[model samples]
Target: MRVVSLVPSLTEAVAATAPGLLVGATAWCTHPAGLDAVRIGGTKNPDVPAITALAPDLVIANEEENREPDLTALRAAGIEVLVTEVRTLEQAFSELERVLVHACGLDRPRWLDEAGTAWWDLPAPPEASRAVVPIWRRPWMVLGRDTFAGDVLSRLGVENLYAGHADRYPRVPVDDLCAAAPDLVVLPDEPYVFTADDGPEAFPGLPSALVSGRHLTWYGPSLAEAPAVLGAALRAARP
Candidate 1:
């Protein structure tokens, strides 16, 4: 079955499972390096006409990374679109299974099984740390309530300062974020690229952990390495 994926994580998942099945993907879908799929466009503004031209049997998308109007447009073009909403680790696994077994009609990838075992078998950290995780700068956007990344951090015993906020991704002042008295500040390198030298200075007295955005944010094969990858980074941000 021919497939086109709009989400980078999903693209990687599908490509890893069966590279030949992926005929097209978004320009942002850069994973499993040297992927030979046709570039459709960005997640927010995919080239629907170009995608429809591919005549894929299935198109994979994510609720958070993609817009509804685009998905509707794809459906309007008579393309079978599979939209996934993954807000938690469990949901991520379940959705991926659905996409692979149900949508693409392929055998489950071994990496996915390893990922589930890695996450579920992890022993919770004994000490919890309070932190401010900033996704973007300039205007400053933070992870808020009910977000997948927030849930992942919670599992590692790190409390996000704005997790109780009404907005899923809240734009807040950097000064106020510091004033919250979080023991540490966590920064990821995607959506906004925060490096070790660049991000640490903003926190002043607070220790900052510059983490891998792919591992912390994306759900796919990376989920298997997240427990160890994020754990080491968060471990350095202690009081």
Candidate 2:
């Protein structure tokens, strides 16, 4: 079954589970190191014509990572599009199964079970640290309200300050973020590439945890290592 994945996490999941099933993927699907699929542009703006030409049996995407218009266009071209919505870790596991097992007709991979076990076995921190997680700068958007990233951080004992905001990814002024007075700043290296020199200076005296965006955000095989990876980064910042 030929598949075109617009979501990076799902791309890694499919590529790792069943090699060569993906005929096309977004340029941002960078996991598994050396993937050899046709590039179909980025997640927000996939090249509809280029994807249609690929004639994939399935195109897997996320409701948040992908744009609605692109999914509509793909469906208009009679392409079967599997759109996933993952707001929590459990939801992520379920969605991964939906895409790989139900949609692709592949047996449930062992990594999926191991990932679940890994998270389940994690020892929760004695106290959760309130955190402000910025996904982007300039306009300053943060992980707000029911996000997969927020859930991931929560599992690692870092609570998102904007998790109750009405918008999923809300644009707030940097001043407002600083005023929130989070215990620490959790910076992921994607969507904006917040580096050690770049992001931490904004919050004086506050420990900034520079984390792997793949482990912090993506919900594929990385799930197995996220608890240890994120926990270490969080521990380093707090220590």
- How high is the CA lDDT of each candidate model? 0.91, 0.92
Evaluated with TM-score, which candidate comes out highest? 1
Scored against the true structure, residue 156 in model 2 reaches a CA lDDT of 79
The residue-by-residue lDDT of candidate 1 on 61-80, one tens digit each, is: 99999999999999999999
How big is the positional error of residue 36 in model 2, measured in Å on the Cα after superposition?
1.5
The runs of at least 3 residues in candidate 2 whose Cα sits more than 4 Å from the true structure, single-residue gaps closed, are none
Give the clash count for each candidate: 0, 0
TM-score of candidate 2 relative to the true fold: 0.97
Q: On a 0 to 100 scale, what is the lDDT of residue 130 in model 1?
A: 87
Expressed as tens digits, the lDDT of each residue in 6-104 for candidate 2 is 999999999989978999999999888889899999999899999999999999999889999999999999999999999899999999999999999
Which candidate number would show the highest lDDT if scored against the true structure? Answer: 2
TM-score of 1: 0.98
